[model samples]
Target chain A: MKEVFTMWKNTKMVVLTAICGAVYAAVLIPFKPIPLIPGFTEIRPASVLPVVFSLFFGPAGAWGSAFGNLIGDFFGTLGIGSIFGFFGNFLYGYLPCKVWSYLSPQTEPLINHPALWLKYIFTVLIASLGCAIPISWGIDWVGLIPFSVLANIIFLNNFFVSLILGPILLFTLYPRFKKWNLLYSQIGEITSEKTFLQNIGFIFILIGCFGGLLVGNLTSLGHFTGKIGINLIPLIFSLILGTILI
Target chain B: MSIYLYLERNTFIHRLHPVTKIFLLLLFFILLLLFSSPLPIILVTFFLLLVSAFSRSISNLRKIWKLMFILFTFTIILWTIFLKNLNYALAMALRLNALIFTGLIFLSVTRIEEFTYGLNKLGLPFRVSFALTLAFRLVPSFILSAQTTIQAQKSRGLDLETGNLVQRIKKFIPLLIPILATSLRNAELLAIALECKGFGIKKKRTSYLDYKFGRNDFLTLLTIFLLYFLLLKIF
Candidate 1:
């Protein structure tokens, strides 16, 4: 968190962040009509970007993604939802980089080994789940969509869409970026054994995916009719635990 | 597919302070959420449309009308299924329209730089706001590069159009990769330029442009707050 502020003071990081945001918005703005769940989510080719750039450009990519989503919302669907969208997109970009750095066996992210491939996929999964939980919670909190429907929509949309596509973009761009000496690895290795991001990841996986599924099942079974508030207890508890761990 | 949303126009809505417009955007968004009745939603939708007309954003509105119509109709159908009432369906549809149109009007009328200036006035840090503004400037160029990348891939017999859902998404990688690579290269060059120009030497920075709340802004703010409270009281 402290590094985020210091990174903001650097001119090079600032410029790079601007460029990443602009390029992301450019990809997103024109694809407004290709809706998967009309009036809510869409087929976002820009979805893969956070993963790709997070690995390549580090914190700048996270800030760029957060701001880019904010600007993109002004095009349409600007509301209370935009706040969640902003933070969700930030984590979308941030978590993968952090997870990749934390979990990667190699000094830098590469696909030369089979184990690294699994780590890459795991990073995307954790990152996508991290994104879906809060956003679905936010949507449900706003009373716009059910937690079940939105959680599934966002999780599947992000995970499946990027699962195949994200790595291809990563593989395509990685060598070039590495050749140019622009990869985040060149900046420094960010892995720290003391950080609680792993606990945060496990908490998200435990609560966000499993807890959301339990609530969805209970709701469908008519066990919790008109009791959304009561139903949120365990989910909220896990979130609090995750925050406390952080 | 490349749509530049901001239109330069000399109109009352265009000339209004950006912060006022931002406030109105937020207000309309909240109002749309607050009011479930069709009448207030319709009223807000009509108000936004009237503002759009005055701003001469008809062309921009035309680009999105089909999409908005589909979304509105879908909302009505879904509401009808769940809420089991035609009027409730209509209200939900109207609410969706108000939410969408308010955003469109704001984007169409506000210039990118004016928006950044508005953020600056509202106490956002200069570097952060400027990064966002710079992103707006760079999007058009990036769009062009994306189109060229798609074309280059097409020339190599990469078919993006003919595919199943998964295949189509997979096909997008060819287009996305080159664009991303080009964007990174461009970003590195810009970083070098910024370092050369001494972008971070001074912690305290000054801006040549300024935005101030005027008599009109105050009056507009008062009217909107009154209208919002009145809407709340009425419903």
Candidate 2:
């Protein structure tokens, strides 16, 4: 019975995680005025779902959340992201989950001072070793994959310095934030607590509810126009606010 | 977009709505998946350049030149070494040149406001349209942030300039921490602001920017569509 419940919870978490990621990716479309970060990269913060999921559900939850991010890319109008992005963001979620799962709540997210640096070091290492070659080749950027090995080696070795700096962000001196009450009022204790199960459920539920709205709007507002860039600030700001306040 | 872009403004293409331009670009993108050949592609490039000239301001020529000098030169060398077919290489480079500039023609002149208005007219929601606006502004903001981060590292005596191939790459290690950290913080801020504004609510939004469909808009779309159709039929 316990196993059955765990499986059910896992399924729910995965579905929810993907939905949030999809929402983050999909909500980006109306901003047709802005060119994406040069070569199709954007500063997507939907990772909160994955990070939180990894913390709670372990590796499988991490996997589900990571893969779930393609929701927006697949459904959106541009569809350029759907093909390359499936794997591009998958690992982005997986690494954090793997790392955090590798060490649970008993261990602090920060191994040293300034949690930000360690996170960066971990990210670069994962991108180089786990993602770069596999992603480039998997996505059919075969020509570009030649540099992956070199890129990974050059990247991972420098992780030491940044790792030392990252701990400052976690618990040591990180700001408690002013907007926590906004998020806390509507949301339950499930997400607020640092437990693995609550975090997984909260992350997925949030993404689903959040990302779903944009899709619903897209269906209704068939044609969009006007200062696309300026309009986007609010949407991005909304996502940030949701994670913090809720 | 960077200040480097210069535009050539005129009636036909310029008058066409940004939403229309975006759709046409999409149409072309879909068209490419369906069809790609040298003659048809080259003809398309020629038409794009001609249209591009009329599409924006006169100042965008500098961007065209810089792209040709930098991206063109780089691609040519890379293609030649790998593909090793001089003709194929040159042809590919030219194609890239044409596509980039034509897109730049649109990018240089169309302000975020114009794009938003055009997309909203095309039936996209107010929130989605707004996100487009933020993404554009974020580019330069992100770049400035990256540059400042690098300079700070330099001040810390990172000495990135004197590094080897592996070591030179190592210099970038400092960037991911700060950039990603800032990004996470920004994400929280962006998400909240959007929700409070009633983003993603199902409703017809008011068009803040007025768009006029003059004689030029229709004629231009028809002429291009017809030309594109004819070209497609030819192949």
Worst 10 residues of 2 chain A by lDDT: A182-191
Q: Which ten residues in a row have the lowest lDDT in candidate 1 chain A?
A: A237-246
In angstroms, what RMSD does candidate 2 have relative to the true structure?
Answer: 13.8
Q: List, residue by residue over A22-129, the lDDT tens digit for candidate 2.
A: 323322222221112332222222233334333333333333433444333222112332333454444434444343423332343444544544554554344323
DockQ for the candidates, in order: 0.52, 0.05
Would you list the C-alpha lDDT of every candidate in the order shown?
0.72, 0.42
Please give the range of 10 consecutive residues that has the lowest summed lDDT in model 2 chain B.
B1-10
TM-score of chain B of each: 0.90, 0.71
Q: Give a tens-digit lDDT track for model 1, residues B1-235.
A: 4355778888877788888988888887777888767888877777777777888987877877886788677666655655477787787677766677877888888877888888777888888887887887787888788777767877999875566778778777767777777787866678778778877677788777666678878887888888788878888
